[model samples]
Target: MSPRRRRTEEFTSYYGRPVLKEPTWEALDIAGYIFAGGLAGASSILAAGAQHTGRHRLERAAKLTALTAISASVVALVHDLGRPERFVNMLRVAKPTSPMSVGSWILSVYGPLAGASAAANVLGIFPRAGKAAGIGAGITGSAVATYTAVLVSDTAVPAWHDAHDVMPFVFAGSAAASAGGVAAALAPLAEGGPARRMAIAGAAVETAMSLTMERSGKLSAETFHQGRAGTLLRLSKGFTVGGAVGLALGGRSSRLVSTLSGLSVAAGSALLRFGVFEAGRASTRDPKYVVVPQRERLEQQGRGASDRQGAAAGADSMG
Candidate 1:
């Protein structure tokens, strides 16, 4: 007679469902908002630099891009709200600890300044005032690029929370890359040198930060390379590398090359946002992510207690 086989213990959550709350954010609305907000924020910085440096083509493109991207980002955010009116309520109180509240304030401050800056340039309204507004936008723009990372990382999402230290840098670099891509695509060839340089620098930072994130978490970081998230992140890395290489090849003369490079970087930035969002969802979906960490913590507590008890017993014997 054949011996009966024993099965390994299986880990399960309630009805085999996630023990954590899956993010309620819709992919297109939230993901698109993240990409556009990043673009707007970084473009504002580029616009300010171009304005200061007297690069007319780059300044014009960056200013207009910032305005357009921020407007689109607002629409995406409103679209994601179940009750759009609740967005207005978000501004009623300030919560320093709350990223969402801080983000709302940042947008409010950045939006009008960005709009005024672009409008002043387009309509020749108030150059001095517009420049001042543009500067303000530039200052606030950095927060816009980074605050979203804090928003996601502050949550229970394992992938995001675990990578909190690097998330801001990752998002900031991606934002800069997207903005640089826009400038590269829209500005004249001679004026696009800074844009190309910015693209390369941003890509390098983003790639390095992302790699750091993946390597830092060991098993937990597997969320980045497991399924759909893995596929998108890998593709984002490929596009980022390709875009950077293209920018290097294009130099300052090839408009077509610049355009392709810009497009690739923009695509890569968007894919990275999508990848991170999807990774968070993946982390929540699997029980192991939730269970394993907790189990380890409990084991650690047990060992700590045992060590304390042993030390106390030894002290008592000595006494």
Candidate 2:
């Protein structure tokens, strides 16, 4: 007789149907928006910093990148909506609990500030006013960097919803790296020092957060390591690692190496966003990803209830 072997566990779901509706968001549009918004947000901060420090070339490049990326992000978002007219109506109301509403408002405030900063550079007018707008963009930049995390985690998707605590940091770090990469690529070699440092720091943070999420996310983490999403995430990790190493080796001495590193980091950031989006979609499609976690939650609640009842019985007997 053959020796008995352990079988992998499988979870069943009601009627073999997905427990949650997959996001209606198109991968190209929504993922692009997420990546571009992050890059724009972080670049705005870099622009503001450069402007204050009187680094004209860096300021202009960062500001232009911010404006261009944000504008593209807005376009992607509107296109994803299908009913483009409703995009305008999004501004009509504000709901604190609604991440989407909050994100729209953040963009409204951020987009104009970024555009004004870029325009100020182009028109060579309102120097002080432009500085103020750049500062405002920098301030609102946090929202632009991390609000997408709120947007994704607020959903029913198990993988995304479970990793809410780390998602914002992941996105934030990725955004900063992407912006830094762009700055490194576009700014003069002499002015690229800060960008290089930012890229290195951001890459470190993003990699750490991703590793933590994968280790601590329980079953939800499985989505990040399976099929297409898995492939993309693995690629992102490799690119990020390679970029970080290149930056470290090149330091401030090699502009060519810095530029190449910047490209790698930017590509990694894009892949990270796309991979995350695909993972969330995969989580929704698989009934086990949804059902298993919920079943665990119910079991935990049952245990708590039983313990409470047992405590009550003991208290009555003592009385």
Taking the tens digit of each residue's C-alpha lDDT, what string does model 1 give over 97-216?
899999999999999999999999999988999999999999999888788899889988889988999999999999999999879989998888888888889999989999899788
Poorest 10 consecutive residues by lDDT, candidate 1 = 1-10
207, model 2: CA deviation in Å? 0.4
The 0-to-1 C-alpha lDDT of every candidate, in the order given, reads 0.89, 0.88
Q: Total clashing residue pairs per candidate?
A: 0, 0
Error of 2 at 200 (Å): 0.6
Q: Model 2: what TM-score? A: 0.95
Q: 194-261, model 2: which lDDT tens digit per residue?
A: 78888888999999998787777477788899989999999998888789789878847787888898
User: Model 1 misses residue 29 by how many Å?
Assistant: 0.8
* Candidate 2 residue spans exceeding 4 A from truth: 1-8
